[model samples]
Target: MSVRRPAAEVLQPKSFSFNEKNLLVVDTILSKYPKEKKASALLPLLDLAQRQNANWISTAAMKVISEILSLPLIKVLEVATFYTMFNLKPVGKNLLQVCTTTPCWLRGSDDIVSACKKKLGIDFGETTQDNKFTLLEVECLGACSNAPMVQINDYFYEDLNEDSMIKIIEDIQKGSKPKPGPQSKRTGSEPHNNRVKV
Candidate 1:
């Protein structure tokens, strides 16, 4: 992850060029802070833009954010480009952000990743031709308890195997949002715990 300069010091735009709602949202975010510290709301403002655009933030949107917050273009770019959550390119309707950090990798994230590649027919960072899904491998999502986990759109699936993983993908493809939690019934550690259970 890239180091973030505190939102306090960054420059912001004075006026936004997006939409009334977004401008309203930006206004709300700005209002939460003292009048002199509007720059502190950059993250939420950009997040609102990303959510409105489905999954990614566009360069134009960044420009609008810059203008709205009265920040320099490069400063806004610094925040937008540095975060993996901010997508410069188009992503699928459903984005699968797989956790490939060490714990996830050691457990079975690779298996889940492979299943996604086979089912979607697109490698990581690539979206399916049908525009239904995109696969992305990301670092620790702070879901280590559910080590082998994947975040689809805004939901998380943990303790996954090949079959369960496929089932979850199929569910998403069918427009069903699978409930977030462990795939297996076994209470946590039995699956990921490295210590002997004796």
Candidate 2:
């Protein structure tokens, strides 16, 4: 069965344009394609623009990208709205994505979600007042054997329990880089107490 993402409420910022550094990145992304095929760079350009403008893609930014690539405004908007990776609304500095698919659920992902709701005082799709963290429950993050895991920003932290999850959240709240991934003594997803291949 095909699944659809619940549409995000898109907000239009009054204006948006990349900074000098990002403009250079934008130029490079565009340069990869022939002038006639520059529109082919739409996905990367939108991604770069979203990162440049903060974590969300504004309508204005989409328009600018459309103009640069000479694609219709609708073309850019269609791509941006269709992909969940392109945040339509603003997200907190730290986006916490918990994996709650079958493997994770069986392995106690509910405990992870409970821990987040308890500590953050917010449910999924909500951000903190301080804009520090946004909590979201996502399907498989591809860490099945590491079963219960979460992705914060770009890092995957695995082998989580309630306390460890809370500690990670608290650490981020205090602006420190908590060590990421496999909080247990185990390395990666290797089974416990194993010194060598089975």
Candidate 3:
């Protein structure tokens, strides 16, 4: 079956450029790849641009990345579109990616999702009106041992119950970064709850 795409995503913005600050970063990422394979840095550059662009990879990001890698626009767009990790649309400041894979689901990920929906008043794939948070149900985040986890931006909040999950969102809205990993003090490396792996 042919996969349908969103009416070509009115994403190609007028133009794009990396600011002076990101120029340094872009150069550094590009430097890690041989000149002949500079395009390999596309993923990292796109990620940096997403962080710089409020978690979405816009037309500007695609264009800028294309220019930097001396690649075709379609090539850059293809990569960006293929990866779910790159949000094509605008997202709130804190992107809450809740893992709903088997492990997390078996461990009450549904309840965590419900709590987020009730607390944030937006369903998965929607952002709160205030733009502080966007909710999403994603695949495994590679932290299954700590199942029922939610990643706010770059940090993982794992071993979550509804209460702890909601509390983490509250802390984020209050401009505080909750400590990452298990909420119950059972870090992921541990063999049991209530203990950190030494």
Candidate 4:
């Protein structure tokens, strides 16, 4: 996909001001690496950037982060682009990402997607006119046992049927936190006995 650049006037020199909170996060991540291996902090740094921008990572921001850790631009770019967590473009205030992998699909995520389209009137990768929501179809988020699942903002909503899905969206719209995990009363981390044992 063609990346749309920021307006010419806004494209200025990359300067990163690491605030106390994010600096603490970066420092903690940086501590995990040996002194000489500061470059290993790239993913964590990218995460910090994402958190600051509500899940989006700007190229200029990446460049600035690269400079902070003394890593090459290409190195930072590779890390930024490689991870699905990083968003290159502006995301809506609430990003509604449904897992569309096999397990989720089998659990009726297509119906969830259709519901989202009906409610938001926008398909995946498109933002609502109010800029409040964006719908995206994502790959496995490792909640397959929960089957049909979606992530809003940074929280995951799993084991969804149509009614449950609608309720979750409405809750988010009303500024309430929806309960996470399966609607069927299963907590996360239940061992799947149905799978053939090794």
Q: lDDT scores for all predictions?
A: 0.78, 0.85, 0.84, 0.79
Candidate 2 regions exceeding 4 Å error are: 1-11, 195-198
In angstroms, the error of model 2 at 173 is 0.7
Candidate 3 lDDT score at position 188 = 67
Give a tens-digit lDDT track for model 4, residues 1-198: 122233342344355566778878887888899978989888878888878876677787888788878988898988887888787777778889988999999989999998887777887777787677878899999988788999887788887888888888788778887887776666764654444677
lDDT of 1 by residue, 41-129 (tens): 78888888888876666677788787777899789989987887886666788888888899999998889889988887878766677
Comparing 2 and 4 on TM-score, the stronger one:
2
When superposed on Cα atoms, how far off is each prediction in RMSD? Answer: 7.5, 4.7, 4.8, 4.4
The 10-residue segment with the lowest total lDDT in model 2: 1-10
Candidate 1 stretches greater than 4 Å from native: 1-17, 186-198
Q: Over the stretch 67-175, how does candidate 3's per-residue lDDT look in tens digits?
A: 8899998998899989988988877888899999999999999999999989888877777778888788899989988888988888888889999998888898899
Residues 135-166 of candidate 2: C-alpha lDDT, one tens digit per residue: 88898989888879999988999999999999
The lDDT of model 1 is 0.78
1 or 4: which has the higher lDDT?
Answer: 4
Worst 10 residues of 4 by lDDT: 1-10
What's the C-alpha lDDT at position 87 in model 2? 81
Query: What does the lDDT read for residue 37 in candidate 2?
Result: 87
Q: Candidate 3: deviation at residue 173, Å?
A: 1.8
